[model samples]
Target: ETLTIKTASKTYPLYIGKGIRFQIQSFIQALEREFSSVLIITDSIVEPLYLKEIESSLTDFSNVYSYVVPAGEEAKSFSVFYDILTFALEKELDRKALVIALGGGVVGDLAGFVAATYMRGIAFIQMPTTLLAHDSSVGGKVAINHPLGKNMIGAFYQPEAVVYDIEMLSTLPEEQWRSGFAEVIKHALIWDKPFYDWLQAEIHTLADLRDEKLQFALAKGITVKAEVVAEDEKESGIRSYLNFGHTLAHAIEAGLGYGKMSHGDAVAIGMLFAIRVSEEYYGIDLELQKFRKWFRQFHYPEIPKHLDAASLLQLMKKDKKAQSGTIRMVLMKQIGEVETVKVEDELILSILEKELEEVQQ
Candidate 1:
């Protein structure tokens, strides 16, 4: 079955079915009726998996060139970003070329940023592989990580189309699924209370990744993201609520080093911390213990011991959420809603100390 999600700014169709590769050529042919050449940028991990099938499908319509980079969060670097630009230029790529990011978040971020910058932006498509990409690839927020921060350098350039094939997720490892589910949980906590309740009760572990749960999770997650993007396309105000756990979550990723604690795992811990602070300060009577039970059911890596409250606070201060050297975070007023509030630095330290204390013992 196929569904077309029409945002006010863009209307693109999402086709979800068994082995949909055969239809890719016809879809692009229909799109290419108004466009020209195509540029495909993917990652090493994904290039080996589904790159050939995509190239075969696109070979007939227009001249297509592919650039494969190293996978993981590592690719979201300035060096690689520049390299992709150089390669695109070397290929004689023009403004008419469409950039297809055919991998996960890192690939989307890198490729999308390149398209946003190269020759002053070009049309692009997202062929996402990871469940995490369902959120990142759909949104136009694309960029490379700065040495001092995560996704610090980026732009709000929306994709021309997002082509998701659920079958692409099957090859992802258990840990990879765990890494991406944090965003799923974020979508639920920030916008869908019932989805959050269902996730807590129905989906308890990574083993449930391939189940019918993904359809609901992916659809709901993308819908929440699409709705938020439609309302606040530039992330000027209400859109900041999407960063519910990401303020501290980004700090954890950078402080512990990115690969040590996957993005979702760190965000999970951050979400727990946010709820703890919310209860303490706002009297938000949340079901913290239920979240604790749900979280512990997964194999979350422990926070790195060397990362002290002081260091994490320093990292958080450097984050984009910080204003005039003060920390701010997206906090939940209720399960299905959130707010971006300015939080004092001392409170952040206290929470980190308490969390670390419990973690150590």
Candidate 2:
């Protein structure tokens, strides 16, 4: 199915299906009718996987060149982003040039931001590979990480279209599966009760990464994300709920070093902590036992002993959601429901001591 998200500036389509990458030609043909060249922004890992496919698909259209940046979380670097724009400008890419992002979160964010800024905002298409991209790929949000915080600098630049093909995930390693699964967990926790139940009942090991179950999960995740983005394209309202695990998750990733943990893994721990804090501070019961039971099934890394309660709390308060010296987080009162709430620094520290203490244990 094709979902169209209308922002104030443009209407972007999201194509969700198996092997949809083959249809990328239609999107590029549409862009070609509107442009003169195609600039494919991909990372090292994704370039080898899908760049040629996109090249062949767009061969009938304008000329195409790819800028392959370092893959994984590191591609969101500002220096590398500058280099991409420099390369494009050196090529004398015009406003007619279309930027195609083919990869996971980092590639989407990096390439999307470049499209938003280059020539004061050009068009870009999203070809997402990882399961996690089901969420990041559809949303108009684009960004890069700052040394002090994750996603600190970003713009809400809607893509020309989000083309999601479930087949590309087969090329990913097991660790990438674990990373992507983290976001799937977040989707279920934030908006889908049946999905959460299904995930717990059917998905368990890295080996389960390939199957009908994964496709169902990805479709459900994209639906949830698309609905939220359509309602709050600028993140002023319900869209913030998508960050349920992200406030602390971003801090954890930053504190532990960006690449040490995948975005979803950091978020899994963050989701766990958000619930614990909600239970402690707001008396909101999300049935913590059931939640943790499913999350723990993933067998992800434990929060290191070196990451102390005080240190983690300090990092959390620096999160973008923090206001007036107090840390803010998205917490769930129950399955499929979430809200942004404020927590005192002392209370956060207390909750962290308890949660981190358990994670370390």
Tens-digit lDDT track of model 1 for 1-361: 4555555566666655446655676666656555567778999899899999999887575587888999888899999989888888887888888888989999998889998998999888778888788788776889898886678899878777677888888999887798788888898888889988888877877787664677777877888887787788777887887888887788888876678777888888888889887777687688888778788888776665667999899988988879989888888888988888888887888988988888788
Stretches off by above 4 angstroms in model 1 are 1-9, 30-32
Worst 10 residues of 1 by lDDT: 1-10
- For model 1, how many clashes? 0
Question: What are the clashing pairs of model 2?
Answer: none
Cα distance off (Å), candidate 1, residue 140 = 0.3
State the lDDT of candidate 2 residue by residue for 1-361, as single tens digits: 6767666567777777778788888866654467778898888888887888878887566578889998767678789889999999998999988898888888999999999999899988888888778878877889998876567789989888888888888898777788888887888888888888887788877677565777777878777887787788888888889888887787778788867887778888788888887787767666889767766777777665678888788887777678866888887877887788887888778877777667565
TM-scores, in order shown? 0.92, 0.92
